[model samples]
Target: MSPAELAARLTDPALRVVDCRASLQSVSAGREAYATGHVPRASFADLLEDLSGPVVPGKTGRHPLPEVDSFVGKLRRWGISRTHQVVVYDDAGGAFASRLWWMLRWLGHDAVAVLDGGFAAWVAEGWPVTDETVSEPAGDFAATPRGELLIEGRELAELAPTARKVLDARAPERFRGEVEPIDPVAGHIPGAVNLPFAGNLRDGRFLPPPELRARLVAALGGTPPEQAVVYCGSGVTACHDVLAFARAGLPLPRLYAGSWSEWITDPARPTERGDAP
Candidate 1:
């Protein structure tokens, strides 16, 4: 939903707002920002504690998807009922918030939406903000994982000769192994093509449906949307592309939760550099 649309429905009884601000460099920064000020009636959701599970050495990536039961408990804690119209936002465009949005959809909840342009867009409009934190009574949200919406690194590594399109959501430099600010070795999965998450947005908001569809369709080449998969550094920002797919009215692609970080943990995994096939 657009910031303007969200602001207009702030007082609607079924509307729920979540502040998902986070910094890739520092985990505590998002909560600190929320304490300073946020959309009125918004409750903060920490990317580390609330959204991700504990990292498991070389197995789980930096932001492993939380255990379903634990995430369900969080949903209840946040008062996310099955019927609530949930809107999630973050300061870093929709990078972090899209994770929550995708997770909710993966759990079979269809009423969730990422606030286009995120918290920055809200503030830009001079909408009312408050430092006061709010919490609602526990809700009865349940978990029903949709495995089809996800793709694993192992399966992706073997996708050759098949008509699948593996899209990497990292920056071009990272995709080309030119520079990697995070993660061990640079470069992308052997056959994956680059499609930085930023391509889905313009001036902080997502591009219109037709434009997004054209870009994504062109990226997919001859592969169908169902045969497409997306991933990023630690499986976080890739959701931005998934959200864009939905906005484009295209079939949503699968997410590689472990992503590049976990894929590179095993030295035996193949890595390509310089865009050479």
Candidate 2:
């Protein structure tokens, strides 16, 4: 649903709005922004603490998926019941919001959606904002990990060649090794094709599903969606692509959780630069 639609339903008892306004550069930025002004009845979710697990140097990529049990506790604190309609949003397009969206789906919750165009869109529509924080009673939300929806660095080594059409969600420059701002190394996984996450949006909102489907099909050379494996720098924005696939009514692709950051940790793995061959 659009921000307008959500604003209309803001009073619905089953609707739960989460503010995910985070920045990769600063750990406390999101909450700080939320404190100043946010959508009414919205609770803040911190990416570093709430959404991601601890990182182990050379072992786990940045922003590792939170442990299942711990994440369940977070859901309860956020008042996210199984039946509630979840709407996640971030200022940087849906980049951060999609991570939470994908995580919820990985835990078997399908009633979630990203706030189209994010908080900016909501405010742009002249929707009301509040500096007042909300705290709801804890909810009952359990997580059951869906193993098939996730892939680790070890598994990707074998599957990257044939079974998976690894799609890199970083900007084309990052995918092509022209720039490496965040990760240690440049370039992308060999055989991985560039399909930047920005393509999923226009004027800050997601593109129509049919258009998304057409673009993915063109990029994958008609490869079945099940064979698709999506990744970004550290597996966060890759969820944007996964979300796009689902929004397009296509089969959701497996997430390479560790992605390029993890992929480069081991120098033995091959890397490809320039436009994908």
Please list the C-alpha lDDT of all candidates, in the order they appear. Answer: 0.89, 0.90
The collision pairs in model 1 are none
TM-score of each: 0.97, 0.97
- Per-residue lDDT, model 2, residue 251, is 90
Tens-place lDDT per residue, model 2, 1-277, is 6889899999998989899999989888999999999999899989889889999998888888888899899899989999899988989989999999999999999999899988998888899999998887789998878898998888888663866689999999999999999988999998888999999999888999999989888878878887788999999999999999998999988999989988888888889999987
**Least accurate 10 contiguous residues by lDDT in model 2:** 155-164
Residue 145 lDDT (model 2): 83
lDDT per residue for candidate 1 within 112-207, as digits (tens), equals 999888888898888999999887777899878899999887887777735578889999999999999988788988778898999998998899
- After superposing candidate 2 on the true structure, give the runs of residues whose Cα lies further than 4 Å from its correct spot: none
Off by over 4 Å in 1: none
